[model samples]
Target: MDGVDLGIEPGCIFGLLGPNGAGKTTTLEMIEGLRRPDSGSITYGDHDLVRSPAVARERFGVQLQTSAFFELLRVDETIDLFASFYRHTLSTETLIERFELGEKRKAYVQNLSGGQRQRLAVAVALVNDPEVVFLDEPTAGLDPQARRNVWDSVRQLRAEGRTVVLTTHYMDEAEALCDQLAVMDHGRVLDEGQPQELIERRQPGAFIEVAAEVPITGDLRLPGLERVTHEGPKTVLMTQRLDETLGALAEWAKQEGVPLTGLATRTATLEDVFLQLTGRSLRD
Candidate 1:
């Protein structure tokens, strides 16, 4: 976080990505007015965030990683309580329907499943009808279907022209939802760009992956290979000159008497970009 000499465009979904304790949450907290930066400025639209935080709050919606809603309160009661803080709010009926909480509207908050609780928090965020929304790990620990549902609401937010700033460790979610993003590590921005553009910049060559039962001992310095890296049983080779690399590998496989196993070549992706930027797997 070399101070965001950056701005998240209105009506855009901007993702902040990093591993745990990399300061992604810190940066987002500062922007959401949950934590103050030790020495920097945050301006939200025309409001001076430091000087007029209340004004900024009137326009900001934030969903923290962990919510502390009253466990004994009904879903409608929780929504109503939060809505009372805002100048304007969507009706409880509409929020419940939008979040698919209709069947559970009268249920206690603590009785809701993890995914349901997450959705309730999202619904609470929108109660203010703010101009900007921040979601921190909105779908962490969720099942596949639950994650997809969360994504659907985010897409709906984009369609409604609301600015969203999301912080998540999941690379696939960043690729799917973000138009522009910054990857952070150790409280610093390591890379920033459109996901596809970043991938192209990092790996212009084809990346072939090989997971061998045996280790590759020697450095693979062939005529066509551009880069070689190994992690445990996995190895990735980058090559612009694909034909030559594949041909040489075929010859070497025969000569060395090693089986070519778990070999695959796919177009580069955001995961590759993260790997190139951080020198580690995104999930690591």
Candidate 2:
């Protein structure tokens, strides 16, 4: 990580968003005190975490991108094992109930489904009842329903007054769940703000999507159009004056004998802002 900086507010869900190898995990490890930076300071309130690693370990709970526990261990036993490591802890039964793993309490870790395992991982992370929680790509491999389940858990943590910090490559997830976000690429922070604020700052206008049998080349000039980009089969026109641009597009299509098979207009989104800033898709 190079010169990546962030300020996470208490009792809020803060996110670090980037694609693979963008230093999101590395940054998290440093802050978690699992890894030390060569030159930099990591602070938590008045304590310097870099120098006092024990302080960070004591006050923060982390669920890594991948967690490995003994497959033979039962769900409740797993939570109990982790709890024993911490001086302060929440009860295993309480964690199981809160994370909706009550039925699987006696089941082995290997016997749980993907979603159940994820919930179990989070339950173990909270064994210490730390003030701050860090989840690294918590829902990376889960199904839609399971992803939403984990999102609800993260929200619950905030509602309970614990600061939540997480990393994600999913733009929609970050936009929906984060109170504040830092967009990162190539091991550096490109931008940071509230999701909507970042969108408005980087992509101020709206987009009109046009679908045509033929390619909508840039040569087709339209009034009030800022730029044109092709995404898959759709040609996206970015513009500030929506009405003027729409009128001009219709007129141009009519004159060119082109049919507007599918046309839609909508406000800018975090995806648009990411494309504008990085000149590539977030998934890339």
Name the candidate that leads on lDDT: 2
Give the worst 10-residue stretch by lDDT in candidate 1: 1-10
Span of 10 residues, lowest total lDDT, candidate 2? 215-224
**lDDT for each residue of candidate 2 in 111-133, tens digit (9 for 90 to 100):** 99999999998998899999999
Off by over 4 Å in 1: 211-215, 255-257
Model 2 stretches astray by more than 4 angstroms: none
Taking all chains together, the TM-score of candidate 2 against the true structure is: 0.97
With a 3 Å backbone cut-off (N, CA, C), the pairs that clash in candidate 2 are none
Q: Provide backbone clash counts, one per model.
A: 2, 0
TM-score of each: 0.92, 0.97
